[model samples]
Target: MIEAISTETTKFRHATVGRTGTALLGIGIALLAAVMPLAAQSGDPRMLDKLGEAGERSWDGLLSGAAQITGAGGLLGFGVVLGWMFGREFVDGTITGLFGLPVSRAQIAAAKLIVYLAWAVLVSALIVGALIVGGLALGLGLPPTDTAGGLARQFALGVMTALVALPVAWVATVGRSVLIGVVGAIGLVIAAQVATIGGAGGWFTVAAPALWALSEGDDVSGLQLALLAPLLILVVGVTLHAWRTLQLNR
Candidate 1:
Protein backbone atom coordinates (compact mmCIF):
# COMPACT_ATOMS: atom_id res chain seq x y z
CA MET A 1 0.00 0.00 0.00
CA ILE A 2 2.83 2.41 0.81
CA GLU A 3 4.45 1.68 -2.54
CA ALA A 4 1.16 2.20 -4.30
CA ILE A 5 0.70 5.53 -2.54
CA SER A 6 4.25 6.59 -3.35
CA THR A 7 3.72 5.74 -7.02
CA GLU A 8 0.45 7.69 -7.19
CA THR A 9 2.06 10.67 -5.45
CA THR A 10 4.81 10.63 -8.08
CA LYS A 11 2.28 10.65 -10.89
CA PHE A 12 0.38 13.49 -9.20
CA ARG A 13 3.51 15.62 -9.13
CA HIS A 14 3.70 15.58 -12.91
CA ALA A 15 0.00 15.66 -13.79
CA THR A 16 -0.56 18.67 -16.04
CA VAL A 17 -4.28 18.83 -15.58
CA GLY A 18 -3.96 18.76 -11.80
CA ARG A 19 -1.43 21.60 -11.81
CA THR A 20 -3.50 23.76 -14.15
CA GLY A 21 -6.68 23.22 -12.19
CA THR A 22 -4.96 24.09 -8.91
CA ALA A 23 -3.55 27.28 -10.41
CA LEU A 24 -6.93 28.34 -11.73
CA LEU A 25 -8.58 27.65 -8.40
CA GLY A 26 -6.07 29.83 -6.53
CA ILE A 27 -6.27 32.70 -9.02
CA GLY A 28 -10.05 32.69 -9.22
CA ILE A 29 -10.56 32.86 -5.46
CA ALA A 30 -7.94 35.59 -5.01
CA LEU A 31 -9.55 37.75 -7.67
CA LEU A 32 -12.98 37.23 -6.22
CA ALA A 33 -11.82 38.10 -2.72
CA ALA A 34 -10.08 41.22 -3.91
CA VAL A 35 -13.07 42.35 -5.89
CA MET A 36 -15.55 41.97 -3.07
CA PRO A 37 -14.06 44.83 -1.04
CA LEU A 38 -13.43 47.01 -4.05
CA ALA A 39 -16.94 46.57 -5.32
CA ALA A 40 -18.46 47.35 -1.96
CA GLN A 41 -16.30 50.41 -1.40
CA SER A 42 -17.12 51.60 -4.90
CA GLY A 43 -20.81 51.63 -4.01
CA ASP A 44 -21.71 48.78 -6.31
CA PRO A 45 -25.38 48.25 -5.56
CA ARG A 46 -24.82 44.53 -5.77
CA MET A 47 -22.75 44.76 -2.62
CA LEU A 48 -25.52 46.66 -0.85
CA ASP A 49 -26.82 43.42 0.53
CA LYS A 50 -23.57 42.16 1.98
CA LEU A 51 -24.85 39.71 4.58
CA GLY A 52 -24.53 40.32 8.34
CA GLU A 53 -23.16 43.78 7.66
CA ALA A 54 -26.74 44.98 7.06
CA GLY A 55 -25.39 47.72 4.69
CA GLU A 56 -22.47 49.24 6.59
CA ARG A 57 -19.80 47.51 4.45
CA SER A 58 -17.42 45.95 6.94
CA TRP A 59 -14.35 43.68 6.72
CA ASP A 60 -16.19 40.65 8.09
CA GLY A 61 -18.61 40.69 5.21
CA LEU A 62 -15.77 41.19 2.75
CA LEU A 63 -13.69 38.35 4.18
CA SER A 64 -16.63 36.03 4.61
CA GLY A 65 -17.56 36.32 0.96
CA ALA A 66 -14.01 35.38 0.04
CA ALA A 67 -14.02 32.39 2.37
CA GLN A 68 -17.21 31.05 0.86
CA ILE A 69 -15.34 30.61 -2.42
CA THR A 70 -13.87 27.42 -1.07
CA GLY A 71 -17.34 25.94 -0.74
CA ALA A 72 -18.51 26.76 -4.27
CA GLY A 73 -15.59 27.41 -6.59
CA GLY A 74 -13.41 24.94 -4.75
CA LEU A 75 -15.96 22.19 -5.33
CA LEU A 76 -15.73 22.47 -9.10
CA GLY A 77 -11.95 22.77 -9.00
CA PHE A 78 -11.71 19.67 -6.85
CA GLY A 79 -14.01 17.81 -9.23
CA VAL A 80 -11.75 18.63 -12.13
CA VAL A 81 -8.70 17.25 -10.35
CA LEU A 82 -10.52 14.16 -9.15
CA GLY A 83 -11.81 13.51 -12.65
CA TRP A 84 -8.33 13.68 -14.12
CA MET A 85 -6.60 11.58 -11.46
CA PHE A 86 -8.99 8.63 -11.48
CA GLY A 87 -10.05 8.74 -15.12
CA ARG A 88 -6.62 9.38 -16.64
CA GLU A 89 -5.54 5.75 -16.40
CA PHE A 90 -8.33 4.59 -18.69
CA VAL A 91 -8.14 7.66 -20.92
CA ASP A 92 -4.41 7.21 -21.47
CA GLY A 93 -4.88 3.47 -22.15
CA THR A 94 -2.67 2.82 -19.14
CA ILE A 95 -5.22 0.91 -17.08
CA THR A 96 -4.02 -2.32 -18.69
CA GLY A 97 -0.55 -1.77 -17.35
CA LEU A 98 -1.77 -1.95 -13.78
CA PHE A 99 -2.25 -5.70 -14.13
CA GLY A 100 1.52 -6.20 -14.12
CA LEU A 101 2.01 -4.41 -10.80
CA PRO A 102 2.34 -6.44 -7.62
CA VAL A 103 -0.09 -4.23 -5.76
CA SER A 104 -3.81 -4.96 -6.04
CA ARG A 105 -5.80 -2.67 -8.34
CA ALA A 106 -7.91 -1.67 -5.35
CA GLN A 107 -4.78 -0.70 -3.47
CA ILE A 108 -3.70 1.53 -6.31
CA ALA A 109 -7.11 3.19 -6.43
CA ALA A 110 -7.11 3.68 -2.67
CA ALA A 111 -3.64 5.17 -2.88
CA LYS A 112 -4.78 7.61 -5.52
CA LEU A 113 -7.67 8.71 -3.36
CA ILE A 114 -5.41 9.11 -0.34
CA VAL A 115 -2.93 11.14 -2.31
CA TYR A 116 -5.70 13.34 -3.71
CA LEU A 117 -7.04 14.09 -0.24
CA ALA A 118 -3.59 15.04 0.93
CA TRP A 119 -3.28 17.26 -2.10
CA ALA A 120 -6.61 18.82 -1.24
CA VAL A 121 -5.25 19.96 2.12
CA LEU A 122 -2.28 21.63 0.47
CA VAL A 123 -4.55 23.28 -2.09
CA SER A 124 -6.78 24.60 0.67
CA ALA A 125 -3.83 26.13 2.48
CA LEU A 126 -2.63 27.86 -0.67
CA ILE A 127 -6.11 29.25 -1.20
CA VAL A 128 -6.30 30.62 2.32
CA GLY A 129 -2.83 32.07 2.05
CA ALA A 130 -3.83 33.82 -1.14
CA LEU A 131 -6.85 35.27 0.61
CA ILE A 132 -4.69 36.69 3.38
CA VAL A 133 -2.32 38.26 0.89
CA GLY A 134 -5.21 39.79 -1.02
CA GLY A 135 -6.61 41.19 2.19
CA LEU A 136 -3.26 42.69 3.06
CA ALA A 137 -2.84 44.23 -0.38
CA LEU A 138 -6.18 45.97 0.01
CA GLY A 139 -5.02 47.39 3.36
CA LEU A 140 -8.08 46.14 5.16
CA GLY A 141 -6.50 47.68 8.29
CA LEU A 142 -5.82 45.66 11.39
CA PRO A 143 -7.46 42.24 11.29
CA PRO A 144 -10.88 42.20 12.81
CA THR A 145 -11.48 40.58 16.17
CA ASP A 146 -12.98 37.55 14.46
CA THR A 147 -10.59 37.47 11.51
CA ALA A 148 -8.54 34.57 12.81
CA GLY A 149 -11.60 32.43 13.53
CA GLY A 150 -13.11 33.35 10.18
CA LEU A 151 -9.96 32.35 8.34
CA ALA A 152 -9.76 29.12 10.28
CA ARG A 153 -13.33 28.30 9.31
CA GLN A 154 -12.50 29.10 5.73
CA PHE A 155 -9.45 26.81 5.82
CA ALA A 156 -11.42 23.92 7.25
CA LEU A 157 -14.26 24.73 4.91
CA GLY A 158 -11.91 24.55 1.97
CA VAL A 159 -10.81 21.05 2.94
CA MET A 160 -14.32 19.87 3.77
CA THR A 161 -15.58 21.23 0.47
CA ALA A 162 -12.96 19.15 -1.31
CA LEU A 163 -13.94 16.12 0.73
CA VAL A 164 -17.54 16.44 -0.42
CA ALA A 165 -16.25 16.06 -3.97
CA LEU A 166 -15.15 12.45 -3.36
CA PRO A 167 -18.19 11.08 -5.15
CA VAL A 168 -16.69 12.35 -8.37
CA ALA A 169 -14.04 9.65 -8.01
CA TRP A 170 -16.79 7.06 -8.05
CA VAL A 171 -18.38 8.63 -11.08
CA ALA A 172 -15.11 8.89 -12.98
CA THR A 173 -14.05 5.36 -12.22
CA VAL A 174 -17.41 3.88 -13.09
CA GLY A 175 -17.93 5.87 -16.28
CA ARG A 176 -14.28 5.59 -17.29
CA SER A 177 -14.46 9.22 -18.37
CA VAL A 178 -13.04 12.34 -16.75
CA LEU A 179 -15.75 14.47 -18.31
CA ILE A 180 -18.47 12.44 -16.64
CA GLY A 181 -17.00 12.91 -13.20
CA VAL A 182 -16.62 16.65 -13.80
CA VAL A 183 -20.26 16.83 -14.80
CA GLY A 184 -21.17 14.91 -11.68
CA ALA A 185 -19.25 17.47 -9.62
CA ILE A 186 -21.10 20.34 -11.27
CA GLY A 187 -24.43 18.64 -10.69
CA LEU A 188 -23.51 18.23 -7.06
CA VAL A 189 -22.76 21.97 -6.74
CA ILE A 190 -26.01 22.94 -8.40
CA ALA A 191 -27.92 20.61 -6.16
CA ALA A 192 -26.19 22.05 -3.10
CA GLN A 193 -27.22 25.58 -4.09
CA VAL A 194 -30.82 24.57 -4.53
CA ALA A 195 -30.88 22.65 -1.28
CA THR A 196 -29.39 25.64 0.57
CA ILE A 197 -31.99 27.96 -0.87
CA GLY A 198 -34.69 25.50 0.14
CA GLY A 199 -33.42 25.74 3.75
CA ALA A 200 -32.02 22.23 3.91
CA GLY A 201 -28.40 23.37 3.59
CA GLY A 202 -27.70 22.54 7.21
CA TRP A 203 -28.71 18.93 6.83
CA PHE A 204 -27.25 18.51 3.35
CA THR A 205 -23.62 17.52 3.67
CA VAL A 206 -22.75 19.19 0.38
CA ALA A 207 -24.00 22.59 1.60
CA ALA A 208 -23.05 22.37 5.24
CA PRO A 209 -19.39 23.33 4.96
CA ALA A 210 -20.07 26.53 3.03
CA LEU A 211 -22.61 27.71 5.51
CA TRP A 212 -20.26 26.86 8.32
CA ALA A 213 -17.50 28.88 6.72
CA LEU A 214 -19.54 32.05 6.52
CA SER A 215 -20.63 31.57 10.14
CA GLU A 216 -23.86 33.34 9.55
CA GLY A 217 -27.33 32.03 8.76
CA ASP A 218 -28.16 28.44 7.71
CA ASP A 219 -27.64 26.71 11.01
CA VAL A 220 -25.61 23.48 10.74
CA SER A 221 -25.64 20.89 13.52
CA GLY A 222 -23.05 18.53 14.84
CA LEU A 223 -25.10 15.58 13.58
CA GLN A 224 -25.32 16.99 10.04
CA LEU A 225 -21.57 17.60 9.86
CA ALA A 226 -20.97 14.10 11.22
CA LEU A 227 -22.75 12.61 8.19
CA LEU A 228 -19.74 13.38 5.99
CA ALA A 229 -17.92 10.40 7.44
CA PRO A 230 -20.30 7.77 6.05
CA LEU A 231 -20.70 9.52 2.72
CA LEU A 232 -16.93 9.56 2.23
CA ILE A 233 -16.58 5.95 3.29
CA LEU A 234 -19.26 4.90 0.82
CA VAL A 235 -17.70 6.91 -1.99
CA VAL A 236 -14.23 5.49 -1.35
CA GLY A 237 -15.58 1.94 -1.12
CA VAL A 238 -17.57 2.23 -4.34
CA THR A 239 -14.67 3.81 -6.18
CA LEU A 240 -12.26 1.08 -5.07
CA HIS A 241 -14.77 -1.59 -6.10
CA ALA A 242 -15.04 0.00 -9.53
CA TRP A 243 -11.28 -0.07 -9.97
CA ARG A 244 -10.97 -3.64 -8.72
CA THR A 245 -13.67 -4.94 -11.05
CA LEU A 246 -12.67 -2.86 -14.09
CA GLN A 247 -13.56 -4.39 -17.45
CA LEU A 248 -11.23 -3.85 -20.35
CA ASN A 249 -14.10 -4.54 -22.69
CA ARG A 250 -15.93 -1.50 -21.39
Candidate 2:
Protein backbone atom coordinates (compact mmCIF):
# COMPACT_ATOMS: atom_id res chain seq x y z
CA MET A 1 0.00 0.00 0.00
CA ILE A 2 2.76 2.43 0.90
CA GLU A 3 4.52 1.64 -2.34
CA ALA A 4 1.35 2.24 -4.34
CA ILE A 5 0.84 5.66 -2.77
CA SER A 6 4.45 6.60 -3.31
CA THR A 7 4.30 5.55 -6.96
CA GLU A 8 1.16 7.58 -7.61
CA THR A 9 2.68 10.58 -5.89
CA THR A 10 5.80 10.24 -7.99
CA LYS A 11 3.83 10.11 -11.19
CA PHE A 12 1.94 13.23 -10.25
CA ARG A 13 5.20 15.00 -9.43
CA HIS A 14 6.72 13.92 -12.72
CA ALA A 15 3.77 15.27 -14.68
CA THR A 16 4.06 18.60 -12.81
CA VAL A 17 7.77 18.91 -13.60
CA GLY A 18 7.11 18.33 -17.28
CA ARG A 19 4.38 20.97 -17.33
CA THR A 20 6.63 23.43 -15.51
CA GLY A 21 9.21 22.96 -18.22
CA THR A 22 6.64 23.82 -20.86
CA ALA A 23 5.57 26.90 -18.92
CA LEU A 24 9.18 28.06 -18.81
CA LEU A 25 9.49 27.52 -22.54
CA GLY A 26 6.50 29.77 -23.15
CA ILE A 27 8.09 32.42 -20.92
CA GLY A 28 11.31 32.24 -22.88
CA ILE A 29 9.45 32.81 -26.12
CA ALA A 30 7.68 35.80 -24.62
CA LEU A 31 10.98 37.25 -23.43
CA LEU A 32 12.58 37.04 -26.84
CA ALA A 33 9.61 38.56 -28.64
CA ALA A 34 9.47 41.43 -26.15
CA VAL A 35 12.27 43.37 -27.83
CA MET A 36 10.89 43.23 -31.37
CA PRO A 37 8.36 46.05 -30.98
CA LEU A 38 10.83 48.61 -29.61
CA ALA A 39 13.29 48.08 -32.43
CA ALA A 40 10.61 48.31 -35.12
CA GLN A 41 9.12 51.57 -33.82
CA SER A 42 12.42 53.44 -33.20
CA GLY A 43 12.53 55.54 -36.36
CA ASP A 44 11.85 59.04 -37.64
CA PRO A 45 8.21 59.14 -38.66
CA ARG A 46 5.85 61.82 -39.92
CA MET A 47 2.68 61.55 -37.84
CA LEU A 48 0.66 62.89 -40.76
CA ASP A 49 2.10 61.16 -43.77
CA LYS A 50 -0.33 60.14 -46.53
CA LEU A 51 -2.89 57.71 -45.16
CA GLY A 52 -1.16 54.79 -46.85
CA GLU A 53 2.47 55.92 -46.95
CA ALA A 54 4.35 54.61 -43.96
CA GLY A 55 7.92 53.74 -43.07
CA GLU A 56 7.01 51.63 -40.03
CA ARG A 57 3.33 51.63 -39.30
CA SER A 58 2.11 50.45 -35.90
CA TRP A 59 -0.27 47.98 -37.53
CA ASP A 60 2.36 46.68 -39.96
CA GLY A 61 4.66 45.24 -37.35
CA LEU A 62 4.47 46.51 -33.77
CA LEU A 63 0.81 45.85 -32.99
CA SER A 64 0.83 42.22 -33.92
CA GLY A 65 4.30 41.92 -32.47
CA ALA A 66 3.07 43.31 -29.15
CA ALA A 67 0.12 40.92 -29.11
CA GLN A 68 2.36 37.94 -29.55
CA ILE A 69 4.88 39.30 -27.11
CA THR A 70 2.31 39.92 -24.42
CA GLY A 71 0.92 36.41 -24.80
CA ALA A 72 -2.56 37.85 -24.33
CA GLY A 73 -4.27 34.51 -24.68
CA GLY A 74 -1.49 32.71 -22.85
CA LEU A 75 -3.78 31.16 -20.27
CA LEU A 76 -5.66 29.38 -22.99
CA GLY A 77 -2.39 28.17 -24.40
CA PHE A 78 -1.46 26.77 -20.98
CA GLY A 79 -4.79 24.98 -20.87
CA VAL A 80 -3.89 23.15 -24.04
CA VAL A 81 -0.53 22.28 -22.56
CA LEU A 82 -2.10 20.88 -19.41
CA GLY A 83 -4.53 18.85 -21.46
CA TRP A 84 -1.64 17.39 -23.37
CA MET A 85 0.12 16.48 -20.13
CA PHE A 86 -2.83 14.40 -18.97
CA GLY A 87 -3.31 13.08 -22.46
CA ARG A 88 0.13 11.52 -22.30
CA GLU A 89 -0.85 9.51 -19.28
CA PHE A 90 -3.92 8.24 -21.06
CA VAL A 91 -1.87 7.34 -24.11
CA ASP A 92 0.69 5.44 -22.07
CA GLY A 93 -1.97 3.67 -19.95
CA THR A 94 -0.44 5.22 -16.84
CA ILE A 95 -3.83 6.50 -15.73
CA THR A 96 -5.02 2.93 -15.46
CA GLY A 97 -1.93 2.02 -13.57
CA LEU A 98 -2.80 4.74 -11.08
CA PHE A 99 -6.21 3.27 -10.40
CA GLY A 100 -4.73 -0.08 -9.57
CA LEU A 101 -2.66 1.52 -6.80
CA PRO A 102 -3.68 1.67 -3.17
CA VAL A 103 -3.94 5.47 -2.99
CA SER A 104 -7.38 6.93 -2.51
CA ARG A 105 -8.87 8.37 -5.65
CA ALA A 106 -9.22 11.65 -3.80
CA GLN A 107 -5.48 11.76 -3.19
CA ILE A 108 -4.84 11.19 -6.86
CA ALA A 109 -7.24 13.93 -7.82
CA ALA A 110 -5.86 16.30 -5.19
CA ALA A 111 -2.35 15.79 -6.51
CA LYS A 112 -3.46 16.70 -9.97
CA LEU A 113 -5.25 19.77 -8.61
CA ILE A 114 -2.11 20.89 -6.80
CA VAL A 115 -0.20 20.60 -10.03
CA TYR A 116 -2.93 22.42 -11.89
CA LEU A 117 -2.98 25.35 -9.48
CA ALA A 118 0.79 25.63 -9.54
CA TRP A 119 0.80 25.60 -13.32
CA ALA A 120 -1.87 28.28 -13.46
CA VAL A 121 -0.03 30.58 -11.04
CA LEU A 122 3.29 30.19 -12.79
CA VAL A 123 1.94 30.69 -16.31
CA SER A 124 -0.29 33.56 -15.31
CA ALA A 125 2.69 35.36 -13.78
CA LEU A 126 4.73 34.83 -16.94
CA ILE A 127 1.97 36.12 -19.18
CA VAL A 128 1.24 39.11 -16.96
CA GLY A 129 4.90 40.01 -16.75
CA ALA A 130 5.22 39.76 -20.50
CA LEU A 131 2.20 41.99 -21.02
CA ILE A 132 3.44 44.65 -18.61
CA VAL A 133 6.90 44.78 -20.14
CA GLY A 134 5.61 44.65 -23.68
CA GLY A 135 3.09 47.35 -22.97
CA LEU A 136 5.78 49.67 -21.66
CA ALA A 137 7.98 49.11 -24.69
CA LEU A 138 5.05 49.77 -26.98
CA GLY A 139 4.56 53.13 -25.14
CA LEU A 140 1.46 52.27 -23.14
CA GLY A 141 3.33 53.36 -20.00
CA LEU A 142 3.39 51.66 -16.63
CA PRO A 143 0.02 51.33 -14.91
CA PRO A 144 -0.92 54.60 -13.25
CA THR A 145 0.82 55.20 -9.89
CA ASP A 146 1.26 51.51 -9.12
CA THR A 147 -0.82 52.22 -6.03
CA ALA A 148 -2.11 49.55 -3.70
CA GLY A 149 -5.41 49.48 -5.56
CA GLY A 150 -3.64 49.20 -8.90
CA LEU A 151 -1.44 46.44 -7.59
CA ALA A 152 -4.46 44.65 -6.18
CA ARG A 153 -6.22 44.75 -9.51
CA GLN A 154 -3.11 43.52 -11.25
CA PHE A 155 -2.71 40.63 -8.81
CA ALA A 156 -6.38 39.82 -9.19
CA LEU A 157 -5.98 39.61 -12.93
CA GLY A 158 -3.27 37.00 -12.52
CA VAL A 159 -5.34 35.06 -10.00
CA MET A 160 -8.45 35.14 -12.14
CA THR A 161 -6.55 34.09 -15.21
CA ALA A 162 -5.13 31.18 -13.26
CA LEU A 163 -8.60 30.28 -11.98
CA VAL A 164 -9.42 29.14 -15.50
CA ALA A 165 -7.47 25.96 -14.86
CA LEU A 166 -9.94 24.76 -12.25
CA PRO A 167 -12.60 24.20 -14.83
CA VAL A 168 -10.08 22.72 -17.23
CA ALA A 169 -8.92 20.27 -14.57
CA TRP A 170 -12.47 19.38 -13.68
CA VAL A 171 -13.37 18.63 -17.27
CA ALA A 172 -10.22 16.61 -17.78
CA THR A 173 -10.95 14.37 -14.83
CA VAL A 174 -14.64 13.91 -15.56
CA GLY A 175 -14.27 13.23 -19.26
CA ARG A 176 -11.07 11.20 -18.91
CA SER A 177 -9.98 12.53 -22.28
CA VAL A 178 -7.53 15.37 -22.78
CA LEU A 179 -8.84 16.29 -26.22
CA ILE A 180 -12.35 16.73 -24.92
CA GLY A 181 -11.14 18.71 -21.94
CA VAL A 182 -9.08 21.10 -24.08
CA VAL A 183 -11.90 21.58 -26.56
CA GLY A 184 -14.25 22.23 -23.69
CA ALA A 185 -11.91 24.85 -22.24
CA ILE A 186 -11.64 26.59 -25.59
CA GLY A 187 -15.39 26.56 -25.91
CA LEU A 188 -15.79 28.08 -22.48
CA VAL A 189 -13.45 30.95 -23.32
CA ILE A 190 -15.33 31.61 -26.56
CA ALA A 191 -18.63 31.52 -24.78
CA ALA A 192 -17.38 34.04 -22.24
CA GLN A 193 -16.32 36.41 -24.99
CA VAL A 194 -19.71 36.06 -26.63
CA ALA A 195 -21.49 36.67 -23.39
CA THR A 196 -19.70 39.99 -22.95
CA ILE A 197 -20.64 41.03 -26.47
CA GLY A 198 -24.27 40.04 -26.04
CA GLY A 199 -24.50 42.20 -22.90
CA ALA A 200 -25.25 39.24 -20.73
CA GLY A 201 -25.42 39.75 -16.97
CA GLY A 202 -22.45 39.45 -14.62
CA TRP A 203 -22.90 35.70 -14.48
CA PHE A 204 -20.67 35.48 -17.50
CA THR A 205 -17.78 36.78 -15.45
CA VAL A 206 -18.17 33.85 -13.08
CA ALA A 207 -15.95 31.77 -15.31
CA ALA A 208 -14.17 34.45 -17.33
CA PRO A 209 -11.04 35.97 -15.78
CA ALA A 210 -10.29 38.30 -18.67
CA LEU A 211 -13.55 40.06 -18.01
CA TRP A 212 -12.22 41.40 -14.74
CA ALA A 213 -9.00 42.66 -16.27
CA LEU A 214 -10.82 44.34 -19.12
CA SER A 215 -13.26 45.97 -16.74
CA GLU A 216 -10.80 47.45 -14.25
CA GLY A 217 -10.42 51.23 -14.21
CA ASP A 218 -10.56 54.35 -12.05
CA ASP A 219 -14.32 54.42 -12.16
CA VAL A 220 -14.94 50.75 -11.48
CA SER A 221 -18.19 50.39 -9.54
CA GLY A 222 -19.74 48.19 -6.90
CA LEU A 223 -21.44 46.21 -9.65
CA GLN A 224 -18.01 44.91 -10.60
CA LEU A 225 -17.60 43.23 -7.24
CA ALA A 226 -21.03 41.72 -7.69
CA LEU A 227 -19.81 40.21 -10.93
CA LEU A 228 -16.73 38.74 -9.30
CA ALA A 229 -18.85 37.01 -6.71
CA PRO A 230 -20.15 34.51 -9.21
CA LEU A 231 -16.69 33.81 -10.54
CA LEU A 232 -15.67 32.96 -7.00
CA ILE A 233 -18.62 30.59 -6.79
CA LEU A 234 -17.65 28.93 -10.06
CA VAL A 235 -14.12 28.40 -8.83
CA VAL A 236 -15.41 26.79 -5.68
CA GLY A 237 -17.71 24.54 -7.68
CA VAL A 238 -14.95 23.28 -9.95
CA THR A 239 -12.67 22.56 -6.99
CA LEU A 240 -15.42 20.61 -5.23
CA HIS A 241 -16.31 18.70 -8.35
CA ALA A 242 -12.73 17.61 -8.84
CA TRP A 243 -12.47 16.46 -5.26
CA ARG A 244 -15.70 14.47 -5.42
CA THR A 245 -14.76 12.78 -8.66
CA LEU A 246 -11.45 11.66 -7.20
CA GLN A 247 -13.08 10.42 -4.02
CA LEU A 248 -15.55 8.31 -5.94
CA ASN A 249 -13.06 5.61 -6.88
CA ARG A 250 -11.48 5.59 -3.47
What number of clashing residue pairs does each candidate have, in the order they appear? 0, 1
TM-score of every candidate relative to the true structure: 0.92, 0.61
lDDT of 1: 0.81
For model 2, the local distance difference test gives 0.51
lDDT for each residue of candidate 2 in 1-250, tens digit (9 for 90 to 100): 4453455446645676455645553354345445554444554343223122212333223223323322235445555655654455555656666556667555655555556556556655555466456556656566455333433444455555555544666566566677876886687667656775676624565334444444444223456546665655675566446544543242
* Model 2 CA deviation exceeding 4 Å by range: 1-72, 85-88, 131-144, 147-152, 206-208, 217-250
lDDT per residue, candidate 1, 151-197, as tens digits? Answer: 77777887898899999999988888888888999988998999999
Where is model 1 more than 4 Å wrong at Cα? Answer: 50-58, 142-145, 216-218
Q: Compared to the true structure, candidate 2 yields what TM-score?
A: 0.61
Span of 10 residues, lowest total lDDT, candidate 2: 47-56
80: Cα error in model 1, Å: 1.0
